[model samples]
Target: MSNSKKKKMPKGSMETFFKVLRMIGNYRFLLILSIVLAAVTVVLQLYVPILFGNAIDEVVGAHAVDFDRMWYYLSRILVMVIVSSVSTWVMSIINNRMTYRTVQDIRAKAIRHIQELPLSYLDQHSTGDIISRVIADTDILSDGLLLGFTQLFSGIVTIVGTLIFMFSKNVWITLLVIVLTPLSFFVAKFISSHSFQMFRKQSETRGKQTALIEEMIGNQKVVQAFGYEDKASERFAEINEDLKNYSQKAVFYSSLTNPSTRCVNNIIYAGVALVGAFMIPGGFLTVGGLSVLLSYANQYMKPFNDISSVITELQNALACAGRIFELLEEPAEVPEEKKEMGKAAGEVNIEHVSFSYDKSKKLIEDFNFESKPGMRVAIVGPTGCGKTTFINLLMRFYDTDKGDILVDGQPIKNVTRHSLRSNYGMVLQDTWIKSGTVRENICIGKPNATNEEIKEAAKRSHSWEFIRRLPDGLDTVLTEDSLSQGQKQLLCITRVMLCLPPMLILDEATSSIDTRTELQIQEAFDQLMQGRTSFIVAHRLSTIRNADWILVMKDGQIIEQGTHDDLMKEDGFYNHLYNSQFVNVAQ
Candidate 1:
């Protein structure tokens, strides 16, 4: 019963890293080309120090200056500079193209995988967290990959090339630089590992904060109505502060890797200068050889700084990749062979159905029921009494744990979900209206609905009056903010009316509108319900008094079921609910 949240490091971080590398496998040709270009640039870069050192030897010791030799080396250096710059530019272009395309493939796969995931996964996670993985996490990974190409790869080439040139000048100096290399790596390794953990924590905290912001903004109306604005703001502030602290610590630790490695390089530089001064007295090395050794020494240490910085970026990229991989690994909905259910006969049977969100608490146990074609069945139950769960089962949003749902004598599981859901039209208590023209919103389910058909459906639902009063009639743009709650409910009803499916589900569809509007809309609903098998979950008992069958459910069991009058005569749970509402209305 403790309320503490556990911090979970993404499982299989290395495995996830390899999976992302495989995503880039398709673009290996471009990656190899970039490496070749980078190698050419590093060769030209390493030659410049050698050319300068030899020119100094030709001019420095003699009384007369060797201007001709100096000029020749300078011209060669200029040519190398231009070629190196062009090669570097070309490599950058190739690397960026490869990185972005790889990220594009990953994001598309994640989105497609999301479609195959079960609704249970979405219900457990937040909308903003899912969006963060798609947008923010992918971008972070790409940035890190790009840094690898620009800095990490090129640094390794420069370091190895510098070592080769250094050894040719003098073995003793080369050995000195080699011995100090491990010290630089030791410093980098110690600092970057600490930074990696901080970065991972920072990424997780960001996802949590983003989810909170989306939830608070989406429910601002309820927050204000309940006078909880201060509480909401305080909650947001707490998460925001947590993110700030985590980000600061991650950046601070990552920043230390560069300077710490550079410090080791500086100490090695002083050691080399002292050792070379002694070698010069014995004529063991020439002035030019000593100068070349010093230049190569600086070149060797530069990569350590570059690599330490790249390590930070690599850690961030891996953390984000871990999140993306986790999303891709989610268990998809059970795949079944597509079975065409041509046209449903609208007969439904719940045969000994049992279900539970949690195994310890059974929500629906051995529920059994049957409805004939074209029967209007009204299901009455108190809140939390498995009302919506019943509709969810029929639509195949969820499969029962132990029993089968049958439509037209065929198990629903055998039918393709797309074709099965298409045969039924639904209007829930919560209305969903996208930002578009009124015509578009009403015809979403039936895209080919004509203007005449749209107007006819709207008129039947009594929604046309308000829609026509708008500036452009059917063409007028309507967002959720533009329409009243009742008008949105009417539009939802109009959509079902337009589809005219053989089976319909209305879950408290008229709960938002006023009494007069409800009565008007109910008349339209009555007309629309003809010849259609409809299942209605209603709290207002009066609206369903004329249903062919009334099912009174309590605590996941159907205690009484018959025509409305028959249930009333029994004076059971349904009678008590109906009489209570009547008494409330009279008062």
Candidate 2:
């Protein structure tokens, strides 16, 4: 198993625990009511043991029994039993409601935070890992919280109330119980503190396992086609084994809390019995009182036992919560400016822009470019040569580390992100199709677009023919069988066509469509770009032959910028890159 990252793990878990407490505290009325009910129930339950001890004292002998006193104590015990039962039930309901609502708020907050998280954060983390936090981790927390509230409050009340009752019977035995009590806490503390890290490791492994399962299942076809089943199984087994080991260790350590504390509890009970037996002859304690002391001793230690066991589950919950707080505390994309950008002129200027995903590895550096209004600027480069990175800069998906990007003579950062992005239409090679009707997907950009407008956009993008064949036409719900790859890309293009913003970005937009459809889509794109400035990122040299200007990029720098014919005439790097495709095609 791979060794997990190591650091001090105490402060974070403790902080998350208190943070969860504060969240539960939000429902002050319910929490306070639950605690009060727990106290009432535990006190009533504690009183019954006293009544039983008094009843035992009343039965001096079979015939000499004080019938009236015995019956009275028994009746009181029965009433206490019934009332405590009702109070316990009511307390459980409040705890459940409080816990369920708190978990709901946390899950909702995580989702809202995820929406605000930066694209960079999303790109760096796995989707499944994030999903685990919102779903699985929160679920574990819900269980822990419900149990903790019900047991923890009542347990403490049980311990305190029992101590008072025991002291009333005999102070010496009560103090003896108190002196031996720290043994149980010492045992619980040692086990819980050690098991906490194991539980944290278990949660982290579970997240990784979920991520791998999501990835492998989502791409099962590719896995099988590439004959990767054996390798995939081996990798999954490794993770599963790691999870099993961590879980086993966590459970083993946590399980010791019950028996270890039970042993100390027995010692306390025996001490009370032996001490009260010796005191009975001298009138320090009575036989009935000795029984009462024994009962209180049992009651007191039961709370410690139950709470110690619950401590393990609480530890697991706190570990999961730490992961959630980690996500919540991440820096979000906070835009500082809100300048209204209305009716952009489609002019953009980039000056000395530099950026890199990693600090040590430079990707884009000293990139300078300018596009006048209504110009079709095509950027061409091999994979990883910063073509998409340039497009990201253009869209401000990433901000430059140095220099400025100005749109319509206004610094891009000076305007709100929503207003800045609203001015441009984007169609990337990778299409995102939600599980919804075709019309719903197409009209997403233009929510109130009329039927005529939607149909015109779909037809121009050459997707209307496919849409009409669906059983429900534009209303067909997209699923695994609903649309093919090319059909999905056409729907994406149909979206941009409906919006028809002031500027356009087409990043291998037609790569999924067939040649005939590509040619038709190109003609449609030409019409779409007629009066708007456009940036076309493409690998097919033929696609950019008529571009007003072509940017030949290599290693994050613009190596050449000219007309296709002019670049071809020069017969340098562009000429060699332009010739290689034909050579590979001939072979």
lDDT scores in order: 0.86, 0.89
What residue pairs are clashing in model 1? none
lDDT of 1 by residue, 545-576 (tens): 98999888888888889999999999988889
Best by TM-score: 2
For model 1 the local lDDT of residue 88 reads 96
Q: Against the true structure, candidate 2 has what lDDT? A: 0.89
TM-score of predicted structure 2: 0.95
Question: Which regions of candidate 1 fall more than 4 Å away from where they truly are?
Answer: 1-16, 64-66, 167-172, 271-284, 310-314
Q: RMSD for each model, in Å, please?
A: 2.9, 2.6
lDDT of 1 at 405: 93
- The residue-by-residue lDDT of candidate 2 on 1-587, one tens digit each, is 11112233444566787899998888999988988998999899888878888899897876899989999999999899999999999998889999999999999999999988877888878989999999999999998888789788899889899988887778888899999999988888788888888999999999999999999998999999999999999999999999999999998998888889999989988988898899999988767888888888888988887877777788889889888878887778874557778979999999999988776779889999999999999999888999998889878788888989999899898888778888899999999999889989999888999989999999999999999999999988899657889999999999999999999999999998999999999999999999899999999888888899999999999999999899999998888889998997799
